[model samples]
Target: MLKGEKLGAAIEAARIKKGISKAEMARHFGVKPPSVQGWVKYGRISKDMLPRVIRYFANEVGADHWGIEPGDPYAPDNLVQLRPKLSAAEGMVVIDRLSVQAGMGAGKLAEHFPDVIDNLRVSKDWLRRNATFTSMKNLGLVTGLGDSMEPTFSDGDALLVDRGVRDVKVDAVYVLSLNDELYIKRVQRRPDGAWLMISDNPSYEPYVIENGDRDHFQVEGRVVFAWNGRKL
Candidate 1:
């Protein structure tokens, strides 16, 4: 969880300074007033709601107001000038978009570039609660394909991959390279010691195999987050 007392109190004071009532705060986050009221009363924010609250502080009050810094934590080491106005320690995590395409079904092996295409800003507190390794070292971005992980990961969606999670920690979404092509699959360890590669969409059949048969199968990374822009 977050460093509670200080952070909670700080959030309260900042919210008051902004003159946003608990109900308004709830509406801002699209959550119920009870959630905000709970935080105001208890002076604590749960891990789940941390993203929205911290973002409010960062956007409305700025990270400095909350004793935080904004910068990309996952920007590549070789890449200089991560973001303007943000120092390395205090800025949104810079996530570079790679040319690589991870298929939700049969994937394509495309030539990838280390191009810094996008700047992604996330709360430092949120990142710490979710990501173990530094974003720069463990994070990579790719475009998703197919309908296997639909709703969870739609077609042509931008995905945030955490390379630090190279192995299956539990039954979750992970990126894998099969026979040179990359893929994003829902994976789980079967009781028989076999691995089950599943798709969120039940329409697709699961790919199950034993651990010893490591040929052609490679673990690329695990999916931490996803996004899609409906150009209307």
Candidate 2:
């Protein structure tokens, strides 16, 4: 039987065997006293929470007498519980890749031609939820670097860039080729044809493109989705 079917039995038997009161057991698991009582009354545990309940029993009691087995594969892995991805709603898609050595904060990124070395597979639904533009042809993966936008986007993060969005839009993050150096910064359009290139972190001062400075800056693309995880 699935672990859910036997959760109450296992917990009840384990508690009775250990001679522990409901209050003490509730305290150990960080649950309300009524919750523990409910578990005994209703054997069924919440499907999503079952895995954690299963783990707690094994680690604390080391009792195999419980019907539920150890290392339950049904439990969602670390990524599922922790990162909470946007999931492949309709299968997956292959996206163009730009490595750290070429893109990111390493140097001036390609303005005209892209050297597509590899591809990244992601849930198409993730793209659908994030993308504003329709064309997948302009989609490319970029490696993020530095802490200019800490707690927002950070170094070693993965960014999904839409090359089609080369126009400066209000409060949008853009990848730019400035003075032969590639940098990712937020842009705000001013009334006088001037613009402000901002960093989320106040430590890095904002840059102003005073109308005349337009020639020095080029919009490479707009960053759409930022995947904050290790680049594997």
Candidate 3:
């Protein structure tokens, strides 16, 4: 069976056992229906989605609810306990998200080497943090969302974003927004007071910001460091 199929079986079994419809399951997990379906049938979901699934199942039927002790051969690791990791095959610049069995192995890596990996990613920018923003100053976590900055800022990379710095240099990488949608891009200001969004990955398209749209976009902060690996 494909990996997604294994994930699908596990999801199907859990939903049936818990009396949750696929739609309810999607809502409970805060994900799209197709994504949930993909998990059960495709055995895969994005890195950000794995934790949610784990929490749902674990809350409903796993260790906290079922009293299944760890290390028991019969103990089942539910989807709610799954952690996500990234994998990038050679020649593929884009990183693929991999769902792992939390507190266990991630696919073949789990079967071969346990406790050695938490997560994985291909971009070095995963370490960029916002050095100076109110909450970020204290939390030091980067708020990464969206896909325009593909190959650099993934849809779900948990950044150790510093919030201490606010100044953005022209043509530098900064997290900003337009129309309430967040974007990560290099800023190139024109003499006419316009900005251009440049993506590092050729796989993505670049955009030019109109003067009228400038007010809609505000610099959240600059990236300093990020973490690209899986969560333990």
Candidate 4:
């Protein structure tokens, strides 16, 4: 929801809070230092780069700092609110479908924070029977692209993500951002605190994030379910 100067201010606040230098930010975005300075000074960024900028800064700080309510779009205000109320009578729960696409192969840019492109309604009983979660507050739907996860979930699958699971609590499939690209991959934490990003398809080589370079990796959410054009 932040735009123009407000957005710039939010980015500056996040940069300062995260202790990221402008030069480092420029390197990350592949721009000159002055471009990043202008982003903080004037909030000028192209439409195409807006999503990436938002995602980077939002992740550095928090989505709420940018007025982004990830899974609940109809809240009365931007301030964090309770999870969406389930219509017990109807036995239904509405989950937001986000514009972000989690690539399974070569990776893609993570797009649109808290932007609901659509909504998927499912029976509350179904969710209880199928998904495992402590709360339903951060449940969302994101499209998966590429064939790296084939046999598990094909390309163009609709993945049910739990945004609340922001860390590698267990070895599982997660939507993560690595080196500025978004991907859906199985992640395992090594004993040494490094992370192993594995593709389900053996054809693709696994990637490792060394313990010392953890700054380039971030777990955005856990993949709880995949609607692969079939049964949920």
RMSD of 2: 19.0
How well is each residue in 131-230 modelled by candidate 4, as lDDT tens digits?
A: 8765676898899999998789898899999989978888989999877689999998999999999998999999998988787788899988888643
> lDDT values of the candidates?
0.65, 0.63, 0.48, 0.75
Which ranges in model 4 have alpha carbons more than 4 Å from their true place? 1-89, 112-114, 229-232
Question: Comparing candidate 2 with candidate 4, which one achieves the higher TM-score?
Answer: 4
Which pairs clash in model 4? none
* Per-model TM values vs. the true structure: 0.55, 0.54, 0.36, 0.61
| Candidate 1 regions with alpha-carbon error over 4 angstroms | 1-91, 110-114, 129-136, 228-232
Question: Of 3 and 4, which scores higher on lDDT?
Answer: 4
User: Candidate 3 lDDT, tens digit per residue, 1-232?
Assistant: 1235655676677778768788887775666898777887866776555445544454233433322345533333443233332334443222211232111001111111112122233333332232323442122344355554555656656554333445455456665644544455667887887787777667656678888987767665555444555321
Q: How far does residue 187 in candidate 3 sit from its true spot (Å)?
A: 1.9
Clashing pairs in 2: none
Query: Best candidate per lDDT, number?
Result: 4
- The candidate maximizing TM-score is 4
Instruction: Write one digit per residue (lDDT tens) for candidate 1, span 45-155.
Output: 666555446544432344444454334332232222322323235745645566568888778784432233344566667656665453555686788989988767788
Worst 10 residues of 1 by lDDT: 74-83
